[model samples]
Target: MAENTCVRCGAIPPSHDVVSVASADGSFRLLCSRCFNTEMADLAEVHAFEHPEFTPVRLSDADGVVHEFHFRSLLFGDQLSLEAFEPVPGDDDYAGFRFQVLGDPRSDPFELLGNLVQKMKRALAVKHLVEDAGHLVVAETTVRGRIEWDGNERDRLPCVVI
Candidate 1:
C-alpha cells in the first residue's frame, strides 16, 4: 500500500507502527503518533485556560447582574480568532464569543475551568458558529486572546454544557 500524508501540514505519513487512525463520520485519517501528539498538544496550549493552573473568572454586561454559565470548551481551526461558548441564563442555550473572559468570582473555579475547555472544542465543530459572517477569517492570537485566570488552584472534572 502507498504511504499517506498529513492533510493539514503535508508531512509524510509515519510507519504504521507509530501511527494511529482517527475516523470521523465516513472519513478516516492516518496520523503518525508524533503528529497526533503534536495536534493534541497544540489544542491543550490554546485551551490551557481550563487547566488547573488557570482559575475561572466571570464578568457581567456592565449592570453587575451575575451571569451564571459554564465555559464548556473552545476550538481553533482555519479562523483567525477563537470563539467561545457558555451556557445561557436559565436555559440550555449557549452563546459564543470572540474575546477572553477573566475568572469568575462567584462560580466554582474547577467546574468553570473544565467546562471552558470542553466548550471551546465543541464550538470549533459548530457549523453555524464557524460559518458565521462575524467570525474571523485569518488566524491570529489577537482575534481571540488568551483568557486570564486568578483563583485557588484545584482539580476539576470536564463537562459539556450542551
Candidate 2:
C-alpha cells in the first residue's frame, strides 16, 4: 500500500478528505481538500468550454410535492443553466432557469447547488413561493425565466434558496 500526495502541493492529505481529479490525458491527480478547493475557486474565473456531467436535483415542498430539474450547462460568469420538465401531464417542453452562483468561488459548484436547494426547501416548508431570477421559478415568473437549455441531470442533492 502507498500513500497518495496532493498533486498541487505535493503534501499528503488526511485520509478522510483526499480529492481526485482527472486530467485531459486520462491520468488522475490527487489533491488535499485545501488544494482541491483552491482549484475549484480558480475554475470560477474561467469559462468551462467543456461541460462536465451534472446530476438532476429534486426539490420538495412542505406538502411533499417534488419537482425535478436537470443541470444543462454553465454560462459565462457565475451563472449555471438548468431545465425543469413540467411535472404536469402533457407538457412537452422543458422550463428553464438561470441560477446565479453567489459567495466565494472556492466552494464546489455541486455544494453550492446543494446549499441553494436547501434554501428552497426551507422556503417551501414555510409555504412560500420560491421565486426569483437567481432562484428557481417557472417561465412565467419573468422574462428571464423563459430561457431554455437542453441536457440531462447528473446528480441529486437536498437544497433550498432563501
Candidate 3:
C-alpha cells in the first residue's frame, strides 16, 4: 500500500483530517476522520460530544467484536461518564444497549488511556495489530464490543473510533 492513503478506502483524505489511528499491530496506517463520518445528510453525527471533546474510543476484541464509546469529562466536573453502544441487526445505527462507566474525577487522563490501551493490547494479544499510513491500530485486538451507526459512512473501521 502507498504511504499516504487509507487501507480501506484507497484514497488520501484532504487537509481536513481523520485521526492517524495507532495500534499495536506495529505498522502505521493513516486514518481519514472524514471517512468515519462520511458526508451525511445529517450533521448531528459529526461531534463526538460537542467540540474539544473527550476522545471517542473504539475498542474491539480479537475476534473483531467492537463498540463505540464516548466520554464526557462531565464538563470537567467531579465525575465523568463513559457510554458504550451496540449495533442492531442489519442496521448500522444501533439500538441502545447503553453501557456507562463513571470515573473518579481525580484519575489521570493519561493513566486512563494507558489502562485502556493495555487492556486493548491484551484483548488483541498475539492476534493482530497494525499501524500503517491510512489507519490506526488494525489490531486483532480484542474488539469484543460492537457499535452501530447509520452506516452512511462508507469507510468506517471494523470498529467504531469514537
Highest lDDT, which number?
2
Candidate 2, residues 46-114, lDDT tens digits: the string is 433333335566777667877665443233235443222223345323332224334333346566566
Q: What are the lDDT figures for the candidates, one per model?
A: 0.39, 0.49, 0.45
- How well is each residue in 65-129 modelled by candidate 1, as lDDT tens digits? 43433322222222111223344555323332332334433345455455555654454433331
Q: For candidate 3, lDDT tens digit of each residue in 57-98?
A: 667755676755543222223443333344455543335333
> What's the TM-score of each model vs. the native?
0.25, 0.36, 0.27
Descending-TM-score candidate ranking: 2, 3, 1
Taking all chains together, the TM-score of candidate 1 against the true structure is 0.25
Winner of 2 and 3 under lDDT: 2
Report the Cα lDDT for candidate 2.
0.49
Q: What's the CA RMSD of model 3 in angstroms?
A: 16.3
Each model's Cα RMSD: 17.9, 13.4, 16.3
**Measured by TM-score, how close is model 2 to the native structure?**
0.36
lDDT of 3 at 162: 29
